[model samples]
Target: MATLLGAGPGIVAAGARRTMTRCDGLASVSSSSHGIERVYLSAEHARVNRTVAGWMREIGMTTRVDAAGNLVGRLERATPSGAPDLDAPALVVGSHLDTVPDAGRYDGVVGVLMGLEAVRMLREPGPDGTGWRSPLPFALEVIAFADEEGTRFGRALLGSSAVAGAWDPGWWSLADDGGTTLHEAFVAFGLDPARVGEAARRPEELVGYLEAHIEQGPELDERGESLAVVSSIASARRFQIVVEGEARHAGGTPYDRRRDALLGASEAALAVERVCRAEHHVIGTVGRLETFPGAVNVVPGEARLSLDLRGELDDARDRVWRSIEREVDTIMGRRGLRWRSAEVHRAPAVFCAPLLQDVVREGIVSTLDRGVDDPATIFSRAGHDAMAIGAVTDVGMLFLRNPDGISHHPDEEVSAGDVARGTRALAEAVLQLAADRG
Candidate 1:
C-alpha cells in the first residue's frame, strides 16, 4: 500500500509542525481571552472563515461559503482554468469548524486543518512552484462545517444537515441563550434562510465523503495505536424528564407520606447508570438536573433532568431506553409521583461504507511500523458532522488518537507525530479512492 502511493514513505517533511502551528493560529479566534470558544454564526466564526479561505487559495482551491455558512474549497482540475463546476463529481473531505464552549484546540479544528494539509500533499507543484494540481479522477472539495458543536444554537449539525439535504425548517425558530432565533442569526450572518436549500448537494455530483477527526475516547490510546478506521458512529437519543409531586413542609411531612420529586429524579438517574452499564457500548448520562421550589425549608415539588443515551446499534439502544423508562416509572409510581418525558433529539447509528473503511485501513497501515500488524478499528462514541452527512452519501472517518480519550475540553490533546501520520494517511486514502474509481 505504501508503494501504491506517489509519496511512498516517511513523514510529509515538517508537515506536522506546520499543521500544529496552524492549529495554534486558529485557537486565537476564540471568543474568550482565556481559551478557545468559537461558535456558530459568530464574529469568531466569520474571522476563521476568512483566514481559512486564504489558506485554501494558497493550495489553488477556489473557495465559497454555502448558504448554511459552511466554508467550501474546491480543487478541481477538470477545468483548465481551475474554476469550480458545481456539477462536477467530487470526493468531499470535511470536518466542522465550530467548537464547544471553552473547547479543546484539536477536536474539530485539527480535522479541518489536516484535511487542508492532505489536499496540499496530494497536489503536484505547478511550474515555478506558484500553485498546485491534482491528478485524480474526481474533483476534491474540503468543507468546514459551521455548527457541529451546536454550542450556540443547542442543535447540532446545522451546516452538514443542509448539505445532506436533511435541513428542517422547524429549526429556524430555535433561539439561543441571547434570545436570537436561528433564522435571525442566519440573516445577521449574511445568509438568507430561504436560500439555504441551495446549499444541498446532489447525490450524483458526489463521489463520496471522508472526514478525519481526533478519537474522542481512550480505545486507540489504550491500545497504543495512533490512527484507526472508524467502523461506525453511535446512535443517540436525548430526552428531558420531569417529575411532579406536591410541595410540602420539609420537616412537617412524615417520611411515609412525603412524595418527593427530587428523590424520584435522583433514583431515576441512578437507574439509568445501572441499566445502561449492563449493555456494551451503551452510555446514559444525566448531565443537567434542576429541582424546583427555592426555599430550603420546602420540599421540591418538581424536578427536571436531561438524558443522553447512545449505543452502537439502534435496536440495542431502543431496548436500553425502554428499560430506563420502566425503571423511571417504577421509581415515580412507588414515590406517589407523576412523571413525563419529552424527546429533544434522536440520531441513528451510521456505519462506514466498506470501501471507504478498507481504504482508511490501508492508509493507516502505510504509516505504521511493520512490527505491529493490523491497524486499529474503532467505533466513534461521540457524534460528529459525519453523522448528518451520512444521510446523503457514502461517509467514513479516520480517528486519530486523542490522549486520555477526552474531548470538548481545553485539555484534549493530539501529538505532532500523530498529525503527520494522520495527514499522510488521509491523503493516501483520497488517492486510493481515485485509483479504485478509475
Candidate 2:
C-alpha cells in the first residue's frame, strides 16, 4: 500500500521517519503499561494524565480543568488574548485517562496522544512556502477524560457523564476501594463539584467529536486489517448476584448436604457462557468474585459475583439477561439455595452518525489506500468517551488494531505503521469536518 497522503505539502515526505518515531512513541506509551504493572493502582493513572497535559502545554495550548476533573487543552483559531472569542463551533477529540488495574497504556493514551500530535503536526509551519500555519479550520479542543473504565469507582463514564450533564452530583458520594468519593477526588484535584453542571452545552455548539482507540478485539487481526472504523458502541448490562447457602465444616459436611453458594455461583457462571454463546454478539463474563466467612476447610456460606453482559443489539443483550434469570431460577430450585440479583448497569447500544462514519472511511481511503481486500469497517464491543459525547454531537471513532488482541493488560500493542495510518485517516477526517462545505 502507498503511504498515507496528508493534506499539506511535505506532510507525506516525513512518513518513513515518522513511522519509526511513532514506533518509539508506542514503545514509550507501552512503557507506561509496564510501570502500571509495577505499581499498585498503576502510577500510570497520574503519569498518563500528566503526560497528555504536558504535551498540550508544551505546544503552547491553553489548558483548563472542568468541574468534573476533565482535562481540556484548547488550540484556538485565534489565541484567547489576541483573537475574538472562538466564534465558530469547536471540534473536540478526546478519550479517557483512567485505566483498569494493570491495563495497557495504549488503551487510553493512544487517542490522547494522536489528538495532541495532530494538533502539533498541524501547528507546524505548512510546507516550504506556506509559512507558519495551523491546519485546523475550527477551534480544536483535546480532552483527556478522568474516568471511563468504571474500574476504581465502579461507574463508567464518570467524567463524560458530568460533561454530558447526565450524571447527578449525588452520585459523587459513591466510594471506591480506598473509600474516596469522587467529590473528594475532585477537591483534591482542585476542582469545584458545584461547577460540574456547567459542563453541558447545547448540541449545536460542537462541530464533531472524534476518538482514535485500540480495537480491543480480534476482528482486525482475524481479517488481516490494520484498522477498524467503528460503526456502533456495544450495549452493556451488568449485574450483581448474591447466593445464600448453609455453611458446614468441609470435612463433616456430606456432598449431598452441602448447599454451597460458591457451587451455585459456579453453575451460574457456566450458564452465562451457554447463554452468550447462543447469540452472535453477546458476551457474558464473571469478572469479580467474593466469598463470605472465607476459610479453607469450610463450605462456602455466601458468594457474590459481578456479571458483565454485552451485545451489539438491545434485544440480544436483553435475551442474555433473561437466559441468566432462568438459569438462576433453575439453580435455586434444584439447590434449594436463596439468591438475589440486582441490576448494576445498563447502557444501550449507541450507533455512530452515518455521515461521520462515512467521513472517517473517506479519510482512510484517501490516505492509506489499502484497497477492498483490507476493508476496515466493523462493530466495536468496547465502550468509549464518544458514547457519552455522542449524546450531544455528531461523533465518530477510529480503531488501531491491537496486535495481540490484548488490552487492559501490560502487553498491549499497536504498530507504528498502524499509528501512522490511523493518524493520517484521523487528520483527513478532521479536516473534512472542520471545513464548512454547506
Candidate 3:
C-alpha cells in the first residue's frame, strides 16, 4: 500500500487539479443548447475524442479509435531492462466520455481524465529523475467509452457492450430524434458498423477493468468522506405505465361520478415510492408523466408515466416492482380506470470482484491516512459501463464524492482535492494489481 509514484499528497493534488481543468474545458464541447450533451457518434463526440487522444499521446501512449468509435490508448509494459513488452495482458482503466442531455461536467469525464493523469504519473521519472520507480508487469489501457448515457439511441452501454462482445446487430436500426439510425450514424462517424465486433477484447487479453467515477448519490457526502469502494451496481427495471379513464369536464364532474386517469396515475407514483422506501437499498422514481387533453378544465382521459426501479439485488428489485404493480392495480381499479404497463429495460446487478475490491481498498488506503480501519463500501444506484464490461471480465469501481450528491445536471460538481485523491488511488490500484501479478 505504499505510495507508488513517490509524490506527496500536495503534488498529487496539484496534478489532479490540472487534469480536472482539462475535463472542464472538454465539457464545453457539447451538442446541447446550454449544457453538455455529447452523444454517441455525434460531431461533439468526435471533438472530445480528438482532444482526449491528444492528451493520451502526450503521455507516450499509442491511441486509436476502435470500431465502435471508442477512443482507446495503450501504454505497454516495460521489461526489467526498460524495453517494452507487447505480449502482456493489459489492465484497463476508463469510463465513458458521453453524457446525458444537459449533463454536468464530471459525471463521466472525470474518470477518463483521471485515468490519463494516472498513466502520466506512472511514466514520470523517479524522485532522482533517473528511472521509473517500478517496472510495469502488464500493459495499461485507457478507454473513453463512446456511449454510456443512451441519450441518442435510448440504449445504454453500446460502446462497452461491443467491447464485451455483447453487441446486438438489432441496435443498428435504432434511431435518434433526428431520424438517424445508429448504423447510419456510425457510417457518418467513419466507423464500419459491420466491423463493430472488431472492438471486442478477449477475456484472456485483459487482467481486468477498473473505473473511477463520481458517487452520483448522497452516501459519501453525507459521511463526509471523499472516496468509497463500490460493492455493486444496482439492478434496474424500467416500465411505461398507462392509465385510461373517461374524460369529463372538471367543473361538471362530481366525486362520485368522476373517473380520473391522472388521479390514478398520481396514486400509483406515490405507491411506487412507498413500496421502494419499505425496502433497504431500493429506489423507485416516476420521472416522466403526461396526461391526455392537457388542460385544467378537463379531467384527464389517459395518463402515461415512466417508472424506474433499482435495488442492490435483482430479486429484491423485482419484488419491489411487483408490489408497486399491485398498488397501481388497486388504485386504478378504485378510480374506475384501466391500467397497463410495458417493460422497457432490465439490467441485473453486477458485483465487484473480491480481489479487485481488495485492490481498490488498498489503493484508497495508500492515498489517505485518516481512519484506515476500513474504507466505505457503497452500492451504486447509477448505471455505468462497468456493468456491460462485467460480462467478459472482472470489473471494479472507485467512487469519488460528488458535492451535494448531484449528477446528470449542470449543478453537479466535484472538488479538485477529492479528484486528486481519486487520481492517486487509481494509480495506486494499477500498481497494486501489477504487484499481485508479479
Candidate 4:
C-alpha cells in the first residue's frame, strides 16, 4: 500500500479534501436541520441541484436541469461554450443526489462530487501543457441524479431510469407520504410529466458511464483495501408480506387457542434469515414489520412485513425467494395463520462491461505506488444508478472503502486519502476509456 504514484497525487488528494468540504456544505441543505434528509423534487433537492450546478460551472461546464429533474453538466469537446450542439459522443460520470432519511453525507454524494473533482483535475493544462484546459476526445458530462433513493416515491432509480429510457407510466400514480402523486409533484416542481421522455438519452449519445462510489459494506474495510473494482450490481426482489390470524383476548386465550400474527411473522423472518444464510451469495432481510391492533394486551390479528432479497445472480436470487416463500407458508400453516405476499419491486442483475472493468482495475492499480497489479473486484449487493444507466451504455464503477462499511446512516465514512486515490482512479479510467474508444 504505497502512496498513490502518478501525476500530482498530492495535489489531487488536496482537491479531494475540498470535495469533502463541499460534501459537508451540501449536507446542510437537508430536510432535517440536524441531519441529512434530501429527497426527490423537494425544496432541498432543488437547492442542492442549484448549488451543485454552480460548482459545475466553476470548472467551465454548462449545466442544465433535465426533464426528470436530474442536474446535468456537460463539457462538450471542441466547444468552449459547452453548448448542446457538439458532434462528439459523451463519457458520462454521475451518481444520485437524493438520500434516505437521516442519511450519511457520503453515500451517493461522494460520487457526484468525486466526478466533478476528477473532471476538474483532467481539465488542467492539456497535452501540450500550453493551455488551462484541452478538450477530451469525447464530451464529458457529470450528472447528479435527483432520485436514486426512491424515498419519496417508493420506486428506486427514477432519475437514472428515466435517463436510461425505462420510465414507467404507472409511476405517475405513485404517491408520497404527503399524498402527492409523482405526476402532481412533477408539475409542482415545474417539470411536465408529459416531457419526462425528453430526458431519455439515446445509446449512441454516449461513450460509456463511470462512477466512483463508497462501498456500503465492510469487505473493503476488513480487507484494508483503499479501492475495489465493481464486478456487478446485484439482482433484487422486494415484497410486502401479510400474515393473518384471528384476534383473541390476551388473558382468556389459552396457549392452544392463541393465534398470534406477530409471532408468526417473527418466525417467518427468522426462517428467511436461516434459509438465506445457508445459501452462498444470497441475503434476505425483513426490513419492516407491523402488527394490526397495536395494543399492550390485545392479540394481533394481522402482521405486515417487508422483505428485501438480493443475490449475485438472478436465478439464485429467485431460487432463494421461492425457498423463503415455501418456508413462510410452512411457518404460517403450523401456526394456524393465512399468509400472502405481493411483489413491490424487482431489478435484474447488471454485469460490468469487461473492457470498462479492466480500465477501472488498471486505474486503481496505477494509483498504487507499485504494490499490487490486481485489485479485488466486489459484487455489489446494493443497487446503484449504474444499474439503471447500464441499460443505455457500457457502465463501470470504482468502490472506495467505507470504514466499517456502514452507509445510509450518519456513521458512513471514507478518508481523504481514499478520496484522493478514488478520484484519480476514476479520472484515469475515463481517460483509458477515451483512448480505447479512439
Q: At residue 31, give the lDDT of candidate 1.
A: 89
Candidate 1 C-alpha lDDT tens digits along 1-438: 552555433336456788889899998899899889999999999999999999999987899999999999998746556554556798999998889888888888888888888888777542445333447778899999999989998999999999999999999999999899999999999999999999998888898899999999999999988999999999999999999998899999988988888999999999999999899999999999998895798888999999999999999999999999899888888999999999999999999999999988888888877855489888988999989988889998999999899988889999998998998889889878887887
TM-score between candidate 2 and the true structure: 0.88
Per-model TM-score on C-alpha atoms: 0.95, 0.88, 0.96, 0.95
The sequence of per-residue lDDT tens digits that candidate 3 reaches over residues 246-309 is: 8899999898999889989999989998898899999999999999998989999999999999
TM-score of 1: 0.95
**What is the Cα-based lDDT of residue 250 in candidate 2?**
92
| Model 4 accuracy (lDDT, Cα) | 0.89
lDDT of each: 0.88, 0.74, 0.90, 0.89
Per-residue lDDT tens digits of candidate 2, residues 1-438? Answer: 232233353553354245345324533532243444211123444455555577689877788767676778887775445573566567888887666766675776678777776665556654554423544556788888878887766788877887777877677787777888877766766667788787775676678788989899788878777777799999988899999998899999999898999988889899889878988998999998888789999999999999998899999999879878998899877997999989988888988888788767776775554465334788889889888887788889988878769888777878767776776677767766655333
lDDT of 4 at 392: 95
Backbone clashes in model 2, listed as residue pairs? none
91: Cα error in model 4, Å = 0.7
**Worst-scoring 10-residue span by lDDT in model 1:** 125-134
- 1 or 4: which has the higher lDDT? 4
Question: What lDDT score is found at residue 243 in candidate 4?
Answer: 93
For model 4, residues 314-375, the per-residue Cα lDDT tens digits are: 99999999999899889899989999999999999999999989989988987876766878
